[model samples]
Target: MSTYNNQETQEIPLVKKFPKLKVLPHVNLINSPTPVEKMMRSSEILGGMNIWIKRDDLTNSKYGGNKLRKYEFVFPHIQKKNKKRILTVGGLGTNHGLANVIIANDFGIKTSLFLVDQPLTHHVRENLLCDYYYGADLNYSKDTKGAVYHILKDLVTDWSSYYLCVGASNSVGTIGFINAGLELAEQIKKGDIPEPDKIFIAVGSMGTVLGLFIGLELAGLKTKIMGISVLDENLNSTKKLQKLIRKTMNRLRKIDKSIPDVSKKLFERFSMNRSFFGGEYGRYTYEGLEAIEIARNDGIELDPVYTGKTFSALVDFCRNNPNAKNETILYWHSKSSVDLSSIYNNVNYKDLPKEFHQFFDGTVEIDDKAVHCIRKKKN
Candidate 1:
C-alpha cells in the first residue's frame, strides 16, 4: 500500500492488527490520512460545539469521495481473481459508476456500466459523459431489474467479467471503511481532532457507515455514528445495517475463527436519521440547498444530493440540542470537492449516447412528482 502525501508503502494497520483475516494484495488508490480539520467557523456558527470535518472529499485529484475507500479493497480482489472486466450497476448519474471507471482505468481494467434513468442534473450529465470519456462500455436499461439481467448474462457469457453491485456495498468492498475507522483512531491519538461525541455520515448503499461502525468497534472507539439516509427513509434501521455488517464480519472471520459474534450491544453504537432525504433519492431539498450555502461560508463545497442533506442533519442536530454545545461532533464529508467543469466544458452532450441526449436537449421533461419540499416554488 502507498499514500500520495508521504509516498510510504506499508501494510494497512487493520491487516497487521488482525493477522488471521484474509486480505487480497492492495494497491494505493488514495492519499492516506485525508486531513481531519476542525470546522472552526461552522463550529462557532453552530452553538460553539467542537465541530470537525473528515475530508474524504479530497481522496484524489480527479475523482474523490467515500466510494474510493471501497475501491481500495474491491479493485485488488478483482485483480487477484484475474478478472478482465468489471461489470457494475447504478443510476444514470451515479458517482459510484464514475469513480469505478476512473480508478479501474489506472489498473488497465475494463468497466461496463448498466444504468437506469435518473433525474437530469449537471452532476448526473457530467458523470454520464465522463463514463464514456473514461472508456466504460455503457448499457442503458429501462429499469434496475433489466440492468441486473444484463449483468448476469454478461457474467455467464464472458467468463472473464465480474459483477460488482452498486456502490461496491458487498463484504469485500466494505473493508476500505474499516481502514478509514482505524485511520481516524490514529488521527485522534495524534491530537488532530478531539474524540467526537457523535459522527455524522450519509448513508446510501450502506457499506460506508457499516464499515465505519465495524472499524470503530475494532479500534475500541465509543463515538456514536449518525447515519443520515440519502436513499429510502426506511433503511435507517439497525436491523437493515446489521444484516450487511454481519455478512462483512463473517467474511472477516474467514481469516480468523475467533471473531466476536453479533449482538444487540454492538448495534447500540450507531443511530439512523432519515428526516433529510427530501423526497426521492435524486431530488434536491430546501434544507439541502441552505446547507450548501452555509458550508460555502466556511469555504467547503457540498453537492446537493448527498453531502448537503447529511450536513443539514448535522446542522439540525446542533439547533435542536442547544444544551449539548460543549460536546464534540464530526461530519464525514463524503462528496468529492474537486470541480469537473473543465471536463464537462470540453464534451458536447450530443456526441454521447443517443438516449442520454434528451437530458441535455430538454425534450425529456423531469416528472413533477420526482422533486419535493423546495423553497423555490414551481408553477
Candidate 2:
C-alpha cells in the first residue's frame, strides 16, 4: 500500500492540539456502528488489492442512507433556532429530501421542499406522494438545478425562519463527519478493519466530503478520500464548496479562539479532488447501470444517481491505477432499497417499466398497520 506522503501528513495536526471550536448542537439521526465489510468478489472483479464496503446504507433510521449522518448535525440547530418550517432543495426523487421529511416529521417540524427536474428519472409524482404522506409542503420548479438556489433565496425573504440546506452545506453540518472520523478511528484501533489506503464516496454539494476530510485530519487517520462528483464539476460548485469550507474553518477557529494559523492549510488539505463526474449533474451513463446491477446481485442496494456513479468510478480507478494492486480501497454504500408498498399501493403496476418492476421482487411489503408501528417508534 502507498504510504502517506510527508506533505499530506503535515497538513493535519493533532485535534486536541489544534484550535478549539464551538460546534452547534445537532440531533442524533443515524444508528452508529455501521458495518465495514470486505468485498472479496468485487475486489476480484476489479483485479486490485483488498476492497471493502462501508455499509452506511444499514444506518438505523426509517429512511437510512449517508444523508442521515449529516442530518444528525443539522436538526439540533434547526430546533435551537425555533424554526417552525424547514426549507430544502433537491431534484425530484431526492433521497436527501425524502430523508429530511422523515426526520422533520419525527421532530414535529413542518417542512417545505423545492423540487427541480433533472435529466435522470424524474419520479416527481412518487416523491410528491411521499411528501404528502409525511405532511411536507411541496413546491415544484421547472428551472435548472442551479436556479433553485435563487428560488429558495426568494422564499426565505418573507419568512423569518431557519433554512436547512439539503446537504447542510455549512460548518456545523460538516462537523458530523468530524464525529464520524472519530468513530472510524476508534473502529480502526479496535481492529474492525485495517487502515484503509483510500476511501471513496459520492459528492453532490460537497458537505459530506468536506466533513470526512476534516474529520480524518481531526481524528488523525491518514487516508486518501476520493469524491465522485454526482453534480456538475464547474466553477459554480467549486465556488460554493470553497465558501462553505472557509466558513466552516472560521467557525472552528471561533470555537477554540486559541489555535494558530491552521485554517488555511486545513482547508487546503480538505480540498475535493473531483475527477470522475460523468457529464452534467443527475445524468447516468451505461456503466453506472452495470455497476448498479452488479451491486444488486451482490445483495447490496445502490441508487442510479449517486452510489452507482461512485461505484463505477471506483471500478475504473482500480483498473487504471498501477498502484491500486498494492492499496486498500473502501466504497461507501449510501442508499437504502426503497419500500414500494408505501409508494405504489393504489397505482397500477402496468405503469412501471419492465426494468423498474424488477426492483420489487424481494422488497418487503409494509401495510398500513406496519406503517403505524414504524411511525409509533419515532413518536
Candidate 3:
C-alpha cells in the first residue's frame, strides 16, 4: 500500500537516464516499492538462515502478480502509439494472459490471446474463465507453429493491434523489472532487508530475473541470482536470459548511449537450477506442494505453478547447503497473492469458449499432482 518514497525513487539511475520512462504514458497499476519483509517463521524452521520475501504479490488488489509490473511499462507504450488492441501468447493457465486481459481493460484496449496447451489443472480452468470474464478474445493453438501463425496473421491483418511477446518479455516490459531491481536496492538502503546473498525467483520467460540481474548489478550489489525454471527442462533458461539481457541492454543503449556496456562478468553472477521443474510447465510437483504448505505456515499463498516450485528449490537449496544457514536468502514471490475464488465462482463456464469448457467438465484428463492440490483444497 506504500508508494516508494522520493529519495529512493530518485536514486534509481535508470529512471534518471531514461527520463521518458517517467514522463511516458502509464497506468499506475502496482503499488510500487512493495514492502520487503523477513520470513521469520520459515527462517526459524530452516535453522536460522536469514530469509526474506519481496511482496510483489500485493502489487495490486484487483489483479496483482509480476506480470502487472511488465504491463506498467508495456501498456503505456501501447497507449502512446494509440493502439486499441493487444495480441499476446501464453499457455492455457498463463498468469500473463489473465493479467493482460484485466489490466488492458482499464485502458479500453482489447486483449487477444493465443494460448498453447498445458495440463488442465484448476488454475488453468480458472484463468480460462477469467480471461473471458475480463473480455479477452481467445484462440487455442495446438502447437508452437500454430501459435506463431496466429500472431503473424494478427499482425498482418490488424493495423490497430500491437503484439506483446509471451509474458511481455520484450525490452519495454523488461524495464519494469529493472525498476523492480531499483526498488529493491532502495529497500536495502533503508534497512528494510539486508542485501541478500542470493535471490530465488521463478524464471518462465526470463523478464523478471533479467531485470533483477541488470538492476542489482547496476545498483552495485553482487548478490547471486538463482532462477528456478518452471518451464520445460529442454528450454535453455540461461541462454534465453542472456539473449534477453543483451536485447534489453541494446534498448537501454539507444535511450542513453553514454550508459556503460554490460560485460561477461555480469553473467557469472547468475545460475539456473532446474531440479524443481517436475516435468512439463503446467504439471505440479510434490516438492512444490510441500513448499506451498511450508510457506502457508508463514501465511504466504504460493500457487503450484510458479512460486511454489521456485520456493521448493529455495527449500532444497537451504536444506542441502548447510553452510547457507547463516547466509541471507530472498525469495521473490511472483504469484498473485489475491484469492480468485469469488471471481471464478461467479463466472459462467458456458460463457467461456466452448473448447475451454472441457477443463471444467472433466473431459480433459491432466497430471494428477495439480488436480490433487485443487481437490484437497475443495475437500
Ranking by lDDT: 3, 1, 2
What would the per-residue lDDT of candidate 1 be over residues 238-355, giving only the tens digit for each residue? 5666777788888887777776644344558887766787757778887787778878877899987889889888888898896658788998999887787777778888777787
Off by over 4 Å in 2: 1-23, 120-125, 144-160, 258-275, 338-341, 344-379
Tell me which of candidates 1 and 2 scores higher on TM-score. 1
lDDT of each: 0.80, 0.64, 0.80
Query: Candidate 3: where is the Cα deviation over 4 Å?
Result: 1-13, 16-27, 233-237, 370-379
Q: How would you encode candidate 3's per-residue C-alpha lDDT over 1-379 as one tens digit per residue?
A: 1132234333344576456445433456678778888898898888887889999999988888799888877887897788999998899888999988888877788999998988787778788888888899988886667999989988999899999988889888887888888788888988988899999999888888888888887777878999888776445455676678788888777767765665465667888766677767877888888888889878999988899989988888888997888788999999887778888889989887777777777788765554333222232
- lDDT score for residue 312 of model 2: 75
Each prediction's Cα RMSD?
3.6, 11.4, 4.9
Candidate 1 structure, TM-score to reference: 0.91
Candidate 2 lDDT over 5-51, as tens digits, reads 12221122223334233234545455666788888777777774588
Angstrom error at residue 262, model 1 = 5.0
**What is the overall TM-score of model 2 with all chains considered together?**
0.78
Candidate 2 residue pairs that clash: 20-255, 20-256, 21-255, 21-256, 22-255
